[model samples]
Target: MLYIFDLGNVIVDIDFNRVMGVWSDLSRVPLANLQNSFVMGEAFHRHERGQITDEEFAAAVCDEMGMALSFDQFAAGWQAVFVALRPEVIAVMKQLREKGHRVVVLSNTNRLHTNFWPGEYPEIAEAADKIYLSQEMGTRKPEPEIYLKLLQEEGTPADRAIFFDDNADNIKGAQQVGITSILVTGKETIPAYFANNPC
Candidate 1:
């Protein structure tokens, strides 16, 4: 059987709220208001795609929040907020591979994150059979097209394939495309699923 997994939040813990909290203190803005303006909007997406540089996005965020800070200061502080992997999750992926499952990673990360991945986590780079990064593909999750691309590339029947992701919408998208789906909740549950539901 083939298994597809989400890279961030599922495999690694990513607290965007914590990053925003740091930005809030530096920019002297309230978290609730800043999130409404930038978090839900396309400011981050545009920045990730290089449509706007990090400095430009920081400036825009500052302008919207009615505060000021140097680009270097904001970038350095934000980069520091990202955390490392939980080793238990890495062990789970390695065990799945040992059982002969084709394990792949799918993430909606940008160039900056992808470039630093190998340095941050060598195990993921070495163990994953394949990786489908949205930045390179120009697509993101909850989009049927991206999942369809994975299904096509893996050449696995929908019934024999399973996907584990944190986002409910992405899980639904995988199910809609006929792939078996699991919402990532615990590291132990996945291996247990394979043992009982082997293909």
Candidate 2:
């Protein structure tokens, strides 16, 4: 059996809104008000793909705000709100891998977020036979094409693969492509899904 997991809310605690709040306080940039012009999806996508460096992204925001802040300062402020991984989630992932399952991570994340993953949470990455990250793949979830691409690359039949995610829409997207799925609300509940099923 192959187990695919989402990274962000599934593995770690993240509040991008909190990061923006902290950034606004420190840099005097009102990210909320500049939603359309600065903090929209395209700007974030460029930042994620490294098309724009953190420094460049910050400068763009600063330009809109008529303020200036260094790259180091921006990075520090942006990273301040993130929290650690839940122990239960980590333990369950390791257990899944130990059972000889082909476990992998399939996450919709920016480059910055993916960069922060390794070393800090090696267990999560190591449990995976491989990882499929959105930024690297240039495709995000809740999109059928990405799921099809993953199935092709992993060479795993859709029905034999099980995907776990915190979002219902992503779960739906997986189902649309014939990949079985579970909404990971808690760790204790996950093991039940693995039972009574044969790959």
Candidate 3:
């Protein structure tokens, strides 16, 4: 069986509040305002969909927040959101691999995150058979196209694959594509799910 996992808040810890805090401190923009203007903005969606370049996204964020941070500075603050890998999840993935299950990462993330986390957590990069990112795929989760793309690229039938993600919508997307899916709620739930399901 094939096992597909989501990156943020699933295999790894991520805090958008941290990103907001860093940007807030650097730009002097109120957290709520930043969240509203940038986090919930079209620029972010465009960037995640690979519709815009990193420089364009950074510039848009800076213009929206009225900050003057350079591209490198903005990227630094943006990449600060990832905390660490959830070791238990990594262990589960390793166990799955040992048992001969194919494991892969599917995340609705931009280039900055994709570039940063793998380097920061080499174990995550090493754990997966392949990693699929939204920016590279030109599609994001909760969208059937990306799920279909993954199945097509991997030559895995949807019925033979299992997907785990923290978002209900993403899980629904997988289900829509006819893949078995689990809605991961917390770190402990992963091992419990594995124990009950047994791949």
Query: Relative to the true structure, how large is the alpha-carbon lDDT of every model?
Result: 0.73, 0.72, 0.88
| Deviation from native of the Cα of residue 114 in model 1, angstroms | 2.1
Model 2, 129-165: lDDT tens per residue? 7888776776778889889998888888998788889
lDDT of 1 by residue, 1-199 (tens): 8888888766777766776787778877788876676543466656544466656777776777665678765665466545777566677777779988898998876555665666777888666899888766666677787888888888877898878887888899889989888987665656666578664
Cα RMSD, each candidate: 2.9, 3.5, 1.6
**Candidate 1 has which clashing residue pairs, if any?**
none
Q: Pick the candidate with the highest lDDT.
A: 3
Model 3's lDDT to the true fold?
Answer: 0.88
TM-score for each model: 0.80, 0.78, 0.93
> Per-residue lDDT for 186 in model 3?
86
lDDT of 3 at 163: 92
Model 2 spans with C-alpha error above 4 angstroms? 29-40, 46-68, 186-199
lDDT for model 2? 0.72
Better of 1 and 2 by TM-score: 1
Mind sharing the TM-score for model 1? 0.80
